[model samples]
Target: MKTIEKNVGKKNIVLLVLPQVQLLDIAGPCDVFTSATRFLANDQAGYNVFIVSGTSDKILYSSSGMSLPCSHTIYDIDFPIDTLLVGGTEPGVLHEINSDLYTYLRHIVKETRRIGSVCIGAFALAKAGLLKGKQVTTHWKYADLLQKSYPELEVNINPFFIKDQKIYTSGGVSSGIDLALALVEEDFGTFLASEIARHLVLHLKRPGLQSQYGNALPDYDMMSSFTKEIRDLLKDKLGQAISVEYMADSMHMSVRNFSRVFVRESGMTPGKFLEKMRLDQAKNLLEYTDMGIEMIAGKCGLGSVVSLRRLFLKHLSVSPAQYRKTFKRAD
Candidate 1:
């Protein structure tokens, strides 16, 4: 690795690229730094950005068919990389990364001040032995694959991003921008980061602790169609007083058989699944509406505000009011 001459106080931000990289994973963060150069006026842009291919300095096409011409290759760039960021490749293209690429990544890890990945790029980091036992995250869809592929790594698919020591891992595409903004906040200040976020039209500087679970019940797709129908019934008729026997009767199965099959297929008991659906609905209503807690509970089939409160406390460790305070968005 060659070290570039220091330019007073500028940070060298290098994005490691590969063929068929997720384009947003590269463009989003790079645009942030480029925009930051203008936002942080008077001072020369605090970062000098570079894109380098792990194999060769040539044109590389992204997953979305966008072509980027790269002038620097890992083997050619001896510059000091203040921060090294790797963009993700589609799963189909993931096999293109060879042993030489991992070796280069390990070498760069030794030279760069901080090294991180965007989305499934964490897979490469894990391959390079950089994420052993470290808490990280990636796209929710790929989280299980990453975990199974690297049993030594701790892959949580919840948070928008995670920072464990010098390695930062972000969720899917847009969150890469959030991760970059967070880095800007750390290096510059909250005001600058917030301003950049505002410039990007983002609502707020979302913290890493925030979950990526969208406002919907996680469907148990592996379950039988009959079981899924029962689950759908529970969601649709949340306000009604329904029993396990009723559910089993609807599915034309005995209560004992229904319970066993439901649990085996869905990985959760029927009762627990119903409760989860109701609770997830209640949470969505609270975040997006001004409905009172009692009304929300009634609507979601939690029966009453007291029942909803107890469930929230038991499962989420927060009361309804506190949850609303933290998550609700103002119109």
Candidate 2:
């Protein structure tokens, strides 16, 4: 394994792009690094960024139907990579890495200073055997699949990014920018990274361990029809406090029996599941509306701003105002 200290002069940052690549995953991080060079002024400490593919001159279409230009192919590259990143593709798209590509990845990893994947790009890294015994993260939607398929790897769905020694992995979409900012902070300093983030108009530099927002509904296929009914009922009544007895009665079961079965099927106690659903709804309202904290809390059945604040702090390490400020999209 090569050390980043061995690299001098401008580091070469390369991104490997597969077909159906998520455009934002590549562009957002690339822009972060590129902007750092500008922010550095006369520092002369920056990355030389470029894109590579399995084959040259191939016009790869993004998942959103945009064409991306590739500068080089894996078969032709001869330079040392200071950092290597694999950008993500749409979920469930089959990635066929031939022996040649796999061989190249395995060989290059030995010489590269650092390597990482963005979102579902973890699949590629896991396939290349680069993520063995490493704690990693991906888009929450695919976290379960990644864990099921690669039992040897530790897949965490909460964090926006995870770094196990020199290997790094990031969660979905814009989280790639957070990973890039972290790399910039590592290579340069917080001053330059913060400058680049400000230039990009990012709200906050989210820590790697911040919990990811997930769907409110539980997986129906994994639960009984009665459990699904409870889940549905909870979804519609997120703003109201419903007791375990009420939930059990809705499913025609005793409270003790319902609690046991709920945990067995959903992997969470009923109380915990209800809390998660309420938090998700609160997050949605925070991002999409201009509701006041007290109103939003009442709407989510959190009862009061004080109660919501406690849950937000416990789960996200941020206050409701902070979460809203950081994640609210500009209209």
Among these predictions, the greatest TM-score belongs to 2
Q: Which stretches of candidate 1 lie over 4 Å from their true place?
A: 1-7, 42-45, 207-210, 213-331
Q: What would the TM-score be for candidate 2 when compared with the true structure?
A: 0.72
* lDDT for each candidate structure: 0.78, 0.80
lDDT of 1 by residue, 1-331 (tens): 3222223477889888888888898889998887767776635446888988867647888888888887698878867889988898865566765678888888888887889999888888988899999999987666756776777888776677899999999988777888898888777767777777898887446643433244223436534576678877776788888789999998899999999988766556788878877878888888899999999989887788899999877656678898888889889
Which residue window of length 10 is worst by lDDT in model 2? Answer: 1-10
- Residue pairs of candidate 1 with colliding backbone atoms: 2-78
After superposing candidate 2 on the true structure, give the runs of residues whose Cα lies further than 4 Å from its correct spot.
Answer: 1-7, 35-45, 54-57, 95-104, 144-159, 191-195, 198-230, 237-271, 285-306, 321-331
Q: What digit string (tens of lDDT, one per residue) describes model 2 on residues 124-173? A: 88887988899999987677567767789998777888999989999987
